[model samples]
Every structure is written in C-alpha cells, then in structure tokens.
Target: ILIDGALQNLDFSSGSVEFHNLVIERELNQKVMGGTEDEIYIFYMRFRRGIRVGIRLSKKILLIQLEIDSGFRNGTLGLLGTFNDNQNDEFVLPNGTVFISGASQTDQNLHLYGLHWRTQEISSLFKYDGTQSWSSINNLTFVPLFFNPNLTAFIPNATIRRYAQDICYGEGLNDPTPEQRKPCYFDFSVTFDADIANDTEKTLKTIDTAKKTL
Candidate 1:
C-alpha cells in the first residue's frame, strides 16, 4: 500500500494516449493454511520498462504459479518468466520464506514476484521499461522515487506458518500475546492507458469508459 503514483490520478485527457497501458489488480485473501500451499510477493512497479501481462484468476482460483523477478538487489535473485494457468510448472522455492527489503536504499532495483494462487481475485497485464537500470547499489548518489505493492504468503497453517516466528517472538517481548488475528479481506483496482499506441480503437473506448466510472 505504498503505491507512489505510476499515474495515480489517471485521466485519458479526452483520449490521446501516452501512459503505455498497465492494469494490475489484486484482491488475494488467504485463509490460513488450506492444503496446497505456495505464495510470495513483492510488486514495486512505477514503470521500469517491461509490459505485457494478462493474468486473471478468481473463478474460485487456479493459477498454480507465476514467477517474474528482475533486477533485484542483494545477491541478484534472478529468475524471470514463468506463467501458467494450468500447465508449465517449475519455479517455487522461496523456502527461506521469501524476504525482500526496501530496494536496499534506493536506486530502486526490485521486481520480485512469485505467486501461486488458489484465488480470491488476482489480475494482471504487464509492459514496463523505465530506462532499465537493474540497480546494483553503485554508490547511490540519490535515487529516491518509489512505488510499492509488497505481498507475502506461504501457507501450512500454524497461524499462517508463524509469520517469521511472529516477528521474532514479538521483538522486545512486552509479553502479552494472543489477540491479533485476521483472515481475509482484499480489494484492488488499476486501469491505465495514457498512450495506447497512439489511440488503439480510442484506447479501448477510453478503457471502457473508465471502467464504468468505477
């Protein structure tokens, strides 16, 4: 929930594209552990050049896995492309419980995504390329512009696998556990096309009239 404007206040301006299409959606709610499990998240997109993604899952869920991690700093965890709604497997090992820190102090280099779905609505459409810099912490002069949508989930119950051991036994342990509990609630919305290849059919009828005005 740190989305720092990739066009946060979109307006097709009477139709005449220039934003370059992108519509990522999310509404994933996991109910503790439920049989098959595999989930990881890190979506920080504010345009870094790489677009063309169309993934919609919510017919009661079934998108087994999708991995796309590019330009991530701290030991370059590279592994790109792996989308499936049914077949094509192989790409599920965040076993370290997948942890990613804030772009390692700017120069923004992170797009780590590994999602295995059983569904509660998770949509996608990609195409990004913001001067591709694959950031590698090279004496950061000043790179302070960020976008965010970080999510992480790996199921097997035990209160959702003790979220990193309840943040290391509740840090300074004020000693008073058992009260925090949340199970499901998520909502999403993202529709864009400031420049749809110079007006592709009136930018899909102005993105279907701005998604029926939401």
Candidate 2:
C-alpha cells in the first residue's frame, strides 16, 4: 500500500500492480519556504508473505541526504498486526489490524499499542504490550514500532529487535513463570534515530521494529 501519494495509472496484467511513475508528492517543490507537496510524507510498502521486504519513502531519503543529525532515543518500539488465529482476548487497532504475540519484549510488563497505517489517534502512537498481545500462531514474527514524540516518528531500537526476534524464533529462554504457566515474554527498548525535523517528510523513516514470539 502506498500512503501519502496518489497513483496516476494502474495496471494488473502481469499479476502485479503497476503505477504510472507519478506520485503526487514528486510534483511539489519547497523552494519558497511555504506550503508544498514536498512537505507531505510518503510511505510505500510492498508485502511478501506477511513480511515487508521492500519500502520506498521520501522523508527517510531526505533525512539521509540532509544529514541534519540523528540519534536513537531510549525505549523500544514494536510493530503489531491483526491476530488471524482463533485466539480470544485480542487487541485491535483502529485500522482493524489485530495483533498476537509472535515475540516478546524484554520487559515482562510490556506496553502495547494499536496501530493503523496512517492515523492521528493516540492509540496508534503508544500502548502497553500486556497479556492482550498474544496469538496462538507458532513461529510468526510480530514486530512493532512505537511513536516517539521527541523524534516525531515511529521506530524501534536494535536491542529490542534482536530480543524480539530471538524470542519469536525460539532462540531465547523458554521457561514460563508458575503464576501464568506460560513462556516469558522478552523485553527491549524503542529507541531510534532521526534528523529531528518538524515536517513529516523529514521525520518519517522505515524500520523493521518489533516481532512476535513463537
């Protein structure tokens, strides 16, 4: 799905969708120090078997080009989606994406958040990944991203990503506490780096944040 941009043409003959090479944001210029399409943030993603292997965006590129300065903020961010299994007590994002715990954060009392691709809701921004963030599916990666008001973008730190991947892929501790009698969830931070821009275009960056446990 290509958000923040308009498709000028579309074709579906080759078992794939094709665009006319014109994304609306590309037509705008910000030379006059005012309003322009250049200020609009664009996020382009192509999914393959539930994994986002490719992405195209304007802001992330701009940030690298400008090199305005960047650093990873404290805290881990995770990516969450709809739980597709027959599990109960699931959390749903505003966009109707349900999430199951394919991986765990380092923090036992992890915060969870519901997310829609493009939303202005606080739920989309942050939430605690508590008990409600679990799914019955085995060996599925559930990565999540948290919104950082300081950076004005959603991102996750490397520590959390590795931890989540380990737990989700069955590479971490598998013991569960007697109270819950279930495997323990991993914990990590949502820290990320950014060029520190108020404009959405310069702040938004693509990342493979969090994942679910097996």
Candidate 3:
C-alpha cells in the first residue's frame, strides 16, 4: 500500500485500518465467494475530481474497479490497454506497434502485446518481501507470464480450451454469455480448472454492481 506518498508494505491479516481517509476493510462473505474464499478484503479510495479506485481481494481473486471522468480519456496505457473508445487498437506494444505480421485479436497478437508490457521485478514500483520469488513457481498450478515463451507446458491445448468454452458458454451459469468467454478462458488457462471460470463470472458481476453504486 502507498500511504502519505510513501511505499509501505501492508498486511491485511490483522484488521482493517484507516489512513488518510482511505478505508481498508475486511469482510467475510461466503456466499459471494461461493463458500470458498476464506479471506476477503476491500480497499476503496476516492481521489479529488471524480477519480476513484476500488480493489477487492478474495482467496484467489484480485479485482480492480476504476471510475474516471471522460476528461482523461485516451490518456493512459498499461495492461488494461488504452482507455479510448477504439478497442481495436488495444494490445499495442511499447513501440506503438498494434500489428506486426497481421492484425486482429488473435492469440499470437495478444501474446506479443501482453509480453511487451510485462514488467520486470527491477522496474516494479511497489515493494516486495522476496519471500515468494518468481523462480519458485516450479510447483505452482499455473506458470506466470514471465516464464519462457518457448515452453508450451503452461500453454492451453485444444481439449482444455474446449472445456473452458463449454463451462463459460454453458447454460444455467452465472449470467454466462459469449463475450465473457475471453476472461473465462484466461482463468481456465491459468488453473486448468473449469470451475475457475466461475470466479471470473462473479468478479465481473461485482464490478458491474460497483459501477452502479459508486
């Protein structure tokens, strides 16, 4: 957490804290987490002139909500991509190249675009404890994007992709829709668990509710 313009390492296991009018709250809501998220914390901050940010943490989820005035439109770029109305221009590289060999939102294009924006530990702005290093992900369920791209061990296969599509677009889900398949595929690729897509569904709904209320 960054407080008073200083970078501070925060531990939310103890209790909630109020600093400089920012609220760091801890709440237990089993229903919302599908009775699996043991730890849940919500941090909300409001900036002057209608720039607000909300961060919600669950067991295996980190959701972010942003509210910015249209005045700053098309003025930002990062993992979330451009904030402009043109969605086709997203996945742009640092060199401002939107397409290399071809255009469109293909897997190859997205991989290159996301890889360009990947941050290194040395260039990170936040503090780190160094307890869990990126190199120690040998036994993790999913490999981080920092891993070597040449290895296909962590990449999704045709069968896994089919399963993710079925679970995300399947009927009787949490408002399952065709458009939601992208996020669901991401979660599925990470965990290789079809049920993981449910978390993405719930998170989207949570974001929508926050937009309406705050």
Best by TM-score: 3
Q: Which ten contiguous residues of candidate 2 have the minimum total lDDT?
A: 178-187
lDDT of 3 by residue, 1-214 (tens): 6554456887667656556655465555444434464555556566555576878764456778887878778876756667898876655677776653344565655665666676666665544444654445334343344322222343346555456555655543332344444566567666665455776766677787899998
Off by over 4 Å in 3: 1-40, 100-103, 130-214
Per-residue CA lDDT of candidate 2, range 1-214, in tens? 3223332453333434533542222212333111434443323223322222222344333321211112312111233322334333244444445434445432222344422333333434333234322233222446554323221121145454444334323355432321121111211122121221222222122112222221
- Best candidate (score: lDDT): 3
Residue 150's lDDT in candidate 2: 24
Cα lDDT listed for each candidate: 0.30, 0.30, 0.59
- Candidate 2: stretches off by over 4 Å: 1-26, 31-56, 61-140, 147-194, 197-214
Model 2, global lDDT: 0.30
lDDT of 1 at 119: 17
Clashing pairs in 3: none
Off by over 4 Å in 1: 1-8, 14-48, 54-88, 95-214
